[model samples]
Target chain A: MIVAERKPIDEILGFLSKHQKIMLLGCGGCVTVCLAGGEKEVGILGSELAMARAKEGRPLEVVQRTIERQCDFEYFEGIRHEVKDVDAILSLACGIGIQTVAEAFPDKVVWPGVNTKFLGVNQNVGVWAERCQACGQCVLDKTGGICPVARCSKSIFNGPCGGSQHGKCEVSADTDCAWALIHDRLTRLGQVDSMREILPVKDWSHSRDGGPRKLVREDLTLESGK
Target chain B: MSNGKDFQPKIVAFCCENSGWLAAEAAARLELGYPEKVELIKLPCSGKIDVLYFMKAMEKVDGVMILACQKENCKFLKGNERAKSRVLQTQRLLKEIGIEEDRVTIQYLAANMGNKFVEIVQNMYDKVRELGPNPGKVIK
Candidate 1:
């Protein structure tokens, strides 16, 4: 899932200093799972902001609302009435949700409460690590399912580079060399011969290098006339 | 800072039933004296105390204290740990709003440590007295 961490409270307070009344919008999606921006977080931030403002002799009116998924337009219809009078929106969603809300309410000021980290899996209760770069390519078949693009410091496509030593990457002693993992997995499967096959240069066009990416399903579109 | 005579700071203590509340009860049974300004709100566990509750308490009180079981001694396994994290989060929030982070604190002790409970409350009360009343305390 997409992972994110809440930005520092001081930075958020700075953005809200001018606004007397604001809405704290939360998402029940990836941020919720990661414990960064959810209904609970919304309540925490809202209360903090209110108390902070109250301490300044200028009390702030904060409205808290959490939508099922902030990335979808349908869920936003529920918050339209709540946003009409707020001075700005402090969105506790991933970057996508913030932009989606911005586009939906062009007249309102939208601020991000989280720094979208990466496409990753939860390592533990409060830990997360990058697992995918969304490079628009799937090379796991040849690489023994270990993603070299994200795990490898150099993102090397071939087997262990000269920098790999004792199963660890040269970049850091703590980091496990991605190619070492691939080599070990391939050996276990008796497919070590596949490791000798040289991989071609990765095409950059499919990735962010080309531009913003989008996916469309003509069959799913209402205009498909099917 | 106002002297103790003039400043009667209102302190709210969220006490876990397994340890904190029990300790307070034990202190009372022993005729131990703690600050009367400290009001104890008993809860099933320290983990159940939400940040909203802390913030609301701050609005009406001069300080807030979370009393939980010692690390690894929580009856609910990790209730104290959860409460500790929440306290840290609320402290940062309070600091951001121009309030002293010292106004909020977490004290850990066993149910048998009734004297420790009274000592910690006295310490917090004295500390808050030096800090003065909560500027954000709602007049109404």
Candidate 2:
């Protein structure tokens, strides 16, 4: 899911200074799963803002609404009327949701309430770790389910470097050597021979180096004449 | 605790939708007034209550009560069970922070028990009134 964490209170307060009536929009999709921008979080942010404003003796009017998914237009439609009245919107969705809100409402000022961290899964209760980098490549079949691009601190393509010491990365003694994990995992699955095939240096041109990427599937597109 | 001004304890209650929340709504419908001091927030399941929510509530209110479905009857299978664990975790955190554990309370109730909901709210109000305003808030 799109993992996120709340921004500092001062930063949030700064964004709200100009707006007397503000709405906090929470997404129930990835943000809810990560427990960052859910209904509960909306309430907390609203209450915190209220308290802070009350302290300053400048009580602001704040309302909260949680939609099913902020990424979709249908869910965004639900709050269209409500959004018109508020001076500003504090989006509690991921980066995508924030952008979608901005695009959907060109006139209304939108502020991000949470920092979109990374694509990750909950390691356990309250612990989230990076799992995928979405580097426009899929090599999970060759390696184990883990992606070295995310698990490795350096995003190394091949196996462990010389910096690996006792199965731990030299960068951080606590972090596990991602390549070593892949090597051990491949050996257990009898795919050790695949490792000998020299992996050519990765081409940076196809990735984010060339700027934003777009995929167009001709078969899925509808011709204008049709 | 009587002063010249009427004392209304700041109590925040998190009620599970399957049980406690419905109970509170039912109690309200029946005109069974729970303590006016208690402000209730409903969750899909008490298990879904985040630690951040709990921490924020502790800062703003004098007392908190997490109301979940009765043991062995949670709609989400083990939601009530999970809520119990989180409540315990929050209790320890509050204690560690030097706030009395009694400031946070947890209870299990079936959705139909409107009377029980009122009783719980009244008990929470009384407890919080004794504690008075949150010490952390007072310090600030």
Candidate 3:
């Protein structure tokens, strides 16, 4: 899931200082699972804002709402009427959701309340680590299911770098070397010979440098006025 | 409605179904009188109480408590442990906002302790009375 953390409260308050009436938009998908932006978080933010406004003696109104998925237009349709009266909006969703709201409400100022982090998983309670870079390729099969692109500090695709010592990365002694993990995993699976294949220079053009990417399912495109 | 006397504190208790709530029910069945000041909210497990739930409850009440099973009897293994951490987090938040940390508490109890349930609630009532109303309340 896309892991994210809430931005500092003071920063959020600073953004809302100019707007007396604001709407807090939350996403009920990835941000929800990560406990950053969800229905519950929206309520908490609204209450905190209310308390802060009361303290400042400059009272402001904050309305809270959560969409099923802020990335999709259908989910955003649920809040069109609710957003009509607000001077600005604070989106608790990921970067994609924030952009969608900004695009939908071009005139209104949209603020992000959460720092969108990497694609990762919960190692345990309150611990989320990056696991994927979405590099437009998957070499997990060749590397014994360990992703060097994300797990490695340097994102090394080849053998362990000189920085690796005793299976740990030198960047952070607590972190295990990605290549070392791959080596152990391959040895366990008897696929050590797979490392002999020389990998081509990765084509970055396909990943992020390709300029705003899009996926179009030709048959799924809706007709106009439908 | 206030009769010009100071507001009475609102107390909310989140009772774990397997233990605290069961004890509460048993106390009621046995005619053991607990303070009416505390309202009981039953949860499947205490660990299910998220940070938002604690925040929301604190907003609505002056005092909040989580009643969980005895440490050894926790069916979910770490549910009691998780509840304690969240309760501590809520306490810290309350204190940071100028609210008294004593307003929120986590109490572990045995399921069959009818008399003990009454004692725990009465203790909460006394503590909240001493603390008075919530600092977040509008003074007007």
DockQ values of all predictions: 0.52, 0.11, 0.29
Which candidate should be chosen as best, given lDDT against the real structure? 1
- Give per-residue CA lDDT, model 3, range A1-226, as digits (tens): 9999988778888999988999999999999999899998898777766656655667668888998998887777777888899999999999989999999888889999999999998999779988998887787878888899899998878868899989999999889999999989998998888888876777876677777677778787887823
Better of 1 and 3 by DockQ: 1
Worst 10 residues of 2 chain B by lDDT: B131-140
TM-score of each: 0.89, 0.70, 0.83
Residues B57-115 of candidate 3: C-alpha lDDT, one tens digit per residue:
76657788999988877999989899999889877666555678898899999889888
Clashes of each: 0, 0, 0
Cα lDDT of model 1 by residue, B57-79, tens digit: 88789899999989998888999
| Order of quality (DockQ) | 1, 3, 2
Instruction: Give candidate 2's error at residue A41 in angstroms.
Output: 2.4
Q: In candidate 2, residue B105 scores what lDDT?
A: 74
- Cα displacement (angstroms), candidate 3, residue B28, comes to 6.1
**Model 1: what TM-score?**
0.89
| Residue A189 lDDT in candidate 1 | 96
Native contact recovery (fnat) for each candidate is: 0.49, 0.03, 0.22
Better of 2 and 3 by DockQ: 3
